[model samples]
Target: MPLSAGPHVVVLVEGRSDAAAVAVLLRAHGLDGEGRVKVVSMEGVTNVARDLRKSRDEHPDAMVLGLYDVAEERFVLGALRRAGVPLEAPVDLVDHGFFVCDSDLEDELIRAVGTAVVEDALDEMGHLERFRTFQYQPEWRHRSLTDQLHRFAGSGSGRKVALAERLAVRLDATTTPPPLAGLLGRIAQHLHP
Candidate 1:
């Protein structure tokens, strides 16, 4: 599974949710991501170095982009630095085709669409009642609505991935969170530049 054999660029993400979100954004912006870009989920942020090495080894000339949580910026930066990308700051990472989510992809989406809209999305997806039940739990009851929503999404198996796909589809280019927008723009530049 050489990335170079299939696509012009690779977008490495922390997990499936990030992959799904990136794919949806690329498609929303009119790029044939499935055909032209390879989105790989390293499965965890800690695997950045291993994944980057593998992708580069397999596709020496293919552009590599990444989306990661801000909490994992150090790991991503260290990996990039080891790979010879001279990044001095988070913004510098963006210039090199890596974007960091503020807290994580879920947080970014919640902020982009707002709690009300996300609640509506949950309601539409038939998860609103489940979410409400989770919120009423003793430990969760005191947390902020946003925090509850974030936890609820990650609590259930595959819920984060499912919600990410739905949320990404509901977002347009204008409302896309900054990190996601930057990642897509970086990919577009690589594809068209």
Candidate 2:
């Protein structure tokens, strides 16, 4: 079914990588653009308020969920306020407030796809050594490999879909951080409910 024409849960981020990761998480859990969910990024937070104000205008009836690292939350929230979004409104705000550790989503990608695919993807991107170095950090040792990959994929929708397909092969109907089944369930709930 088609999503309604209203403001959806809009997740605004700082870059394509973070956008991709959040998208993957949303898709995996089954939230989408059929009027219930949407994802966007500002590239830079300087005028994010203006951008979200524009989104508010476009989808006035829906909620807006904003996500940016805590480092930039002040600026991002200021921008949104400048754009006329009310500060106390739940319909207009949500942020995880921090960048993923290990430098970027690539770390999570490496964790998810395994060393082989991670290395292959990096080699394909010509950043193999850089990624390898990052992967070896002590902090990364704490997170499960799959969570890392999901974090990378969840940064944006296109990558989310791509990663979801890959994860689908490895997961079953029940899983946290969402498996494909989780995504489908959300879609069904949103579309049918």
List per-candidate RMSD values in Å. 2.9, 7.7
Residues 1-193, candidate 1, lDDT per residue (tens digit)? 4434567788899999899888878777877645678889999999999999998988777888899998898898889889887775435677678888989999999988889988888898789999988989999999999999999988888888889988899887678999988887877777777
Ten-residue region with minimum lDDT total, candidate 1 = 1-10
Residue-by-residue lDDT tens digits, candidate 2, 66-134: 544445556765775676556774532333222222333344344445656644554654455654554
Q: Give model 2's clash tally.
A: 21
Error of 2 at 148 (Å): 16
Report how far residue 133 has shifted in candidate 1, in Å: 1.0
| Superposed model 2: Cα runs more than 4 Å off | 1-7, 33-35, 83-193
> What global local distance difference test value does model 1 have?
0.86
| lDDT for model 2 | 0.51
TM-score of 2: 0.50
